[model samples]
Target chain A: MMPVEAFLRQDAEAVRPAPALVKRGWRKLLFGDVASSLLTVLISLCALWAVPRVLDWAVFDAVWRGNGQACFDAGACWAFLGAKWPLILFGIYPPDQQWRPIVVVLAFLAITLWSLPERNWTRATATGWLVVIVSSLLLMGGDTLGLQPVPTGDWGGLPITILLTVLSLTIGFPFGILLALGRRSEDRMMRWLSVGFIEIVRGLPLLTMLFIAAILLPLMLPDGVTFDNLSRALVALTFYSAAYLAEVIRGGLQSLPKGQEEAARALGLGRLATLRFIILPQAIHAVIPPLTNTVVVVVKNTSLVLVVGLFDLLSAGRSALTDPDWPSPYIETYILVGFVYFVICFGISRYSLWLEHKLSAGVQR
Target chain B: MARPSPARESTASASTGWRIAQVAIVLSLVGLFAWLASNTAQNLHSRGIMVGFDFLWRGARFPIAESLLPYDPTDSFGWAFVVGLGNTLYITLLVIVLSTALGVVVGVARRSSHPFASGLSAVFVDTCRNMPIVVQLLFWYAVVAFGLPDTDHASHPLPGVWFTDRGLYFPRLHLDGPLLPGVFVLVVGLGWAWTVRRRDQRRRTETGRSPHAGRKIVAGTLVAAVLVAATTGLRPSLEYATLGRFNYMGGVTLTPEFVAILVGLTVYSTAFAAEIIRGGLDAVPRGQWEAARAIGLSEHQTLRLIVLPQAMRLIIPPMTSQYINIMKNSTLALVVGYPELNFITATTINQTGQALEGVGILMAIFLAISLGASWLMNLYNQKLGLVTR
Candidate 1:
């Protein structure tokens, strides 16, 4: 019943729909109007040749169980992981009390996940983090609530790694903020002290710091006031991370406009009040991405605890390989450990990227 | 605008109070240092641990497996440290060059029109950057380096390059003739080429015409250098490795530890450098590229002449940080027993029981290196920075 002109218009519209995105992309990637297409094809061929071999070695031909003899085939011996999972996860924590570390790790993971969701900043979150830290310490340290007492030296594996990371960040973050403020203080002495501390700490490698902690720190302490290996490493880590974080916080402070402080002052806020209520909130928000990156670095650096003779996750895996039963399957063990690290780090990075996007979007409005 | 009053008096009191508080803080800090020094002194006295750099003059008596400088067990601790430092610098320089080259290629490939190449590069960067460097180093040492065939059955990848569990052996080139005359000729040729290029540039600017003499000058310089080298007979001959009962000899041998550290640092840093380079490239405006194309410049020419210069300004600062990171990371050679600075310091501390002195030396060396590197990079950055009107 349509008119001839309307019919003609409908036909034109139907005919004018561009090619599907897949088709266009396929042409652009493979048959790209020139030499680039050939390059794409060549790369595709190489990947095609490589991907299956890797998949075969990693999955199809991988041996998931049985003895070393069963894994003689030219593929990954995942069986080593299956057998050594407990040792890798719990280290030297007594087999009977392995559940303690498991609980602590779960609590830590829960806290991290709970903190991931975006919300208006509140004091309750700080309280929650505090509770998490206390509960983890109590659970790992034991002796209360009818739990067996475990010395800090007995702590190892993923629990220790996570604890060191979280504790260092939680304790170091405030100090880092303070140091940043001090570095920027109007008072010359405070500024010089802050600069001296940050530069000395940043100039040295974490290994050297750990060495100082494990070896020299004891000498500096008054007699009979001893620190366990874990405590010493934790102290070193906190100070080291504080120095780096101070730099990051300084960067954040530098980015703020002078108008912010002036506005706060005009509103009759004291210096401390202006910093706490106005400048700090904005500066910390601006630096969330880099701060998250520091968290990732902290987690990765926990592996250095191995050099200090602490059995972190990496050290636990290395120890597991020493078992005569799994002498030659170190590749498999390292890959498994590396995967765990990759997951945590990659997740942090993805979250940071997402946070950057959301923050930038907020700025645009 | 009003006359100063009692409020001014109170303000003066407040300023005086602030100054008093500042002085109190300074005094307290000085007191803390004094306490620490006394405590350290007492602790050392009780433990009978000597604290001085006098140990530097003592014989090391510990053999280093690999050293860039000649070292023996009889060498002094100072000489041992020098060897360690040389090894560190050798690896750091090689990694810087290799990572920079790899980063540029991968970064450009990331922006390639080809999806496959870009995707592969992205995967490489993501996988590498996410994993811990120590674990990667372990993998390189344990799986890649240690997994190589034993020396007796070393794999011959190239005619004179042997790959084995012990290390990689490659032909070392030796200059066979007088090098000074060849170097002089090359310098003269380069200077001549520069003069020609500068004159051509002036002419082009003044006359608004492209003489295009720079290319000819460069070619002429290269030919002249080749002729001079031939006349001087300044040839380089390969010193190939000869297989022995236990190991290869007569060639440059890169110990497995060195190879592992080199590969690990290169691969890890290349990922970060690629990201930096990509950021620099993305910072360049698309209009610039279009303008270059509009001006009849080819794609390669546009990239080489127009795009990279702008990108370099953005890249240099971050690239400098990456270089510092690489230098710091070379300390990880300890894990694989490559005997770099950190390892040497640790050994010195363990053997001498002078933890304070060893740590002090370590910190001082790193501080000097870090500060010197930053100074040089800042100078370079100032040169490359945009010239504002």
Candidate 2:
């Protein structure tokens, strides 16, 4: 026979527990959240009401397609954007030869998508630069491809922005790796020179450097030795990005364990061989995330070329808004430009995150 | 036959090679140096431009929008440059303090037990981190300078202050006499409080009683400073911004430029800071917190006395680096015409035609600022590190 206390304890333990939907302290939290949500909705509704009232007078009842004062209403006169999208995107490239930038864009897209596959990546890196060089020369110079020669001054808009980013990264990243290695070297002179160059580049703003290259470099260079404005901007971007990329690569190098280097040495590999065969591969792999971040930063910074009067995307958008036909589409044009930048940056980040997961898979074991 | 010691033989061989390499390196360096110097000299001569520091002390003819110290268009270039440097430091320090505080809070919130707080923090991080800083800067500047209420409508009284596109005009503190004595007294009170708290903590360890030292120190400092202020006879008054015929008067006005820059910098950097803080918090071992609780210390005491002290070493290095980043990013102020160091230097270059000199000075200033920050924080990092060791 069991005692009463034992019976009671057994009874308590015997019943299977029901899972509670809400936690013990959740009521107050839920109530507070609901109240705040309601207030937010009320405020938002008021704003929405006011916005549409204005929009009705400006957009809904306003002229849809017209020139001059015929399109002069309060809301966005987006008709001008429709008219200028081609010119804004293709810039002053000869209308007949507009196919050049279009082909360049298509090639870039194909290469980028194909390179995302691991098997294609090696050839992608080598062939990608070759394609870039060939296509860029075709698009910019035009004489090489039996096309009409279009000076860089005629280049503007989306094509120019993309070209600047690609050229900068392609030139800068390899140089950045060299700088990182030099800075880490035991050789005193190499290390100091590398360090000095990296610091000087990193310390100045890209805008300041771009400004100097635009205004001052011209004076420094003798007549007929002058580089194109686009070339100077590309140079500034490359140097600036290389300094930042070197720092990121240095982070990757520092993250590597001493054992890796020691093991390479034990294998009787010389300094160059060890760096090429063993060290760099692992360091670069470890630094993939920061390298992606640097790329994104570089992409955003391409807009600064606008300050030096290059007609990049931002400048293109600004140009679209300035048309006497659509004087008030500034907000809409800016939003569109912002959307483009957001899409590119967000895509890169997602891809990098995916790569991180893929690479980190076996480390746990 | 003669035999040499191993050390002497090795030294002889090493010295021979070393001397050859040294001579080659030196010769190369000297050659390179001579080439660069002569080329620069020849280039300058061809351009008919004489290079010297004489322009720095010479009177400058330029109008600057904002200067921290007294300056005019007639002021020397050196004076103008100094004022710009001071302004840069001021903005950097202010941004660092504000962003750090906001970042710590957001970081802590991200790790909160509550779901809403964590979700909010995650959204903030994603939105701010992914967006281009330049776009954000332009957006904020437009919202403030163009989108906000016009200056005409802003004169309507709203809680004793006027808010407008021009600025937030509020009552400014007016002092008839120097408040230095009051400040000195307050500082002394703080110092005394620290000493007393340390003494009380030591006494508690020996005597085995609850110290309540923190409360005692707070009480002592508050009492001491308030009493000193009362006795010091400091005449303080309020000067509210007045609506005038032409402009708002009698107030310390904040320009829209300052507001936009502050907002942009704070919002951008805080997202990064939040990530770093969350990382620091995660790096602390869970066992430490459990151990503190096991000893019967309350949660607050455990957090303050155990978790935070241990986590600080990890927290500080990233935090200081973020501070340095924000300092550099403040140069973005030039985009909006904020007369910061870069903007001033840009103007100087335009006027002086000393592009190389101006750029060199700007780079040097930034490098010094970054290195100085790293050095100062390294001292604290060392101190915190010793605690764990």
Candidate 3:
């Protein structure tokens, strides 16, 4: 597939010397000019002062394993993590049924990895996701296939985080597409309604929306009509995500050339057919990068569920600290939970970068 | 600027279908609203709740730990909301200014020719950006309140700055007298400095001659400060936070909650905003820099005269959204128990048992602020936006 000239350029790039450049780099950074040299010295001194203290606290003096007693006076009580991993990861979900969450987490992760590349996205991928979603819900909310029924009240940890994200996105994505379409449509009423919903929701913080869900939704519902806290929070998140996703989708819709739709119309295709066959595929592909970023933001925002007393991952970790064995490894637990979030967010963000690079490469070619 | 083409005329059947679609959407929306409204009315009636703003005028009967304005436990709920709003805006404003400055530094650092600076900044940006803001807030709160030493063993980092479990305390200068006249003169002096800087900049651009504008600004500020103090007390004074029997007794203190939220927001937002700024700077073509060099302009002058203004066209739009984000994120102070708008709303709901009104007020205030801020930014953005051919 590659031309000889391009192959030679690639070979030339691969053959560029790095070790010598690195050697010269150090000298250039350390003593390029008087200002640079002074800056290098100042930065070196600060790092020297800070890094050792951090390492001493985080690793050198840290307790790796044992009971909580040895960790009392030690730097980081990482052993506390060993004692608390179950409760932290699976939350108050029943101890014996913990395997269900494990399976659910793995399934979600596997499907996510499989579907990450655009080329792998197929109708089968979509069907697989729907099946995985149904099974995960049935897995989490048991009372099926001879499994014991678990209440929604005890849901927590990574499973809850994954559920909130997946459920909100699934429910919000189509609604967002509708809103984006309406906003650009010729109808005045549809445009106004779509604009109003998007602006009002986007104008407030998610916490406030969650507050409405937590504190106000019950009061607003009719007598004897109720939903659990998690469901209420899901509704809030769905609306919030819908509004945000609409703007992003609108950006994609706008980027699409008008000629695409005009040509479809000239071919005697109806409006809906034009949208489905000609417009959506290209528009969605164009905005894949931003869509992944929105996923990152949602994953992080799920931690705010702690505010409403739901046991998401961060909340589950905090609850794990209630054990009498570990006195205070607050820092260690936060570091671990934060590390988990960092990994997920950072992974998705890097994927978005890769996707952007690939998509733009096609455009340039 | 116009739409590229008009659609072909719709057939009669297509027009009828469109009308039916419109009717279906309108009917569903109206029916849904009606159902929800009825449910709300029934729920409120059965619960014996007096759904209104009457409770807002009653005594708040609670203490706000801190405020920019004076407040007491006897303050009304409305006044409590005001105090909370004031604190929210104050922190948001401080974060906006501080983070923007920090973002600029980090951004420029990322572009530094020195590999060390660039690599270090990249690390800083990655770590801060990846972690959730709530975890950062909690970590910082723990560090300040528990990880650090108690007041008895407070670390005196600077002459009058103490890091203690209770808070961080820095020496503050207290002024006494007619605040109005002093503030008036201060504003006037600022205008004077602005004109001086603008005129100096114009002259420098016109003649390509270096001027000591920085020194002039510093001298001007010093002169203005002296004038301010002279108008107020005519006496230069210092106030230090001293160790009392139980705790620090003077100067200004940033409580653990305040410090935690402030640091968390500033660092987190700076990472994001810095990336925006870095991208803007990078997007300026390499040709611009080489061209400036060919024209014999120094690095600083080239950056000032050429690259930055072009980068501004890219920077302003994203920067506007970042600022709006700061306003919204300030509500996260609620988690640390810092009394911001969300915290006040929570308290009001608990006190009044009127969840609807409390949340309604919260939404109204936020909608106003978010909408108003973006409107102003749009004006500025329009003024600075690129003119297309």
**Best by TM-score, which number?**
3
- Each candidate's fnat, listed in order, reads 0.58, 0.20, 0.77
Taken over the whole model, the C-alpha lDDT of each candidate is 0.86, 0.76, 0.88
User: Could you arrange the candidates by lDDT from highest to lowest?
Assistant: 3, 1, 2
lDDT of 2 by residue, A1-365 (tens): 77778746544356767977865364454345665455446545876888786687457865556664665544455566666776767676777888887877677777777776556659547787686767676766787767788888887777887888888988999989989987997657668978988977775667767876876556556455778889889989999988889999999999999999889977999767999989999999788877887878888889888777788877777766566655555545555677778777777888888877876884667
TM-score of chain B of 3: 0.89
For each prediction, how big is the interface RMSD? 1.9, 3.9, 1.6
Span of ten consecutive residues with least summed lDDT in model 2 chain B: B5-14
lDDT of candidate 3 over B133-229, digit per residue (tens)? 9998898888888788898889988999999989999998966665666566667767777887788889989998867775576577667767776
Query: In candidate 1, residue B285 scores what lDDT?
Result: 100
Q: Where's the lowest-lDDT run of ten residues in candidate 3 chain B?
A: B5-14
Report model 3's TM-score to 2 decimal places: 0.92
In lDDT terms, which candidate is top?
3
After superposition, candidate 3 runs with Cα above 4 Å error: A1-24, B1-14, B176-233
Clashing pairs in 1: none
For model 2 the local lDDT of residue B106 reads: 89
Q: Give the clashing pairs for model 2.
A: none
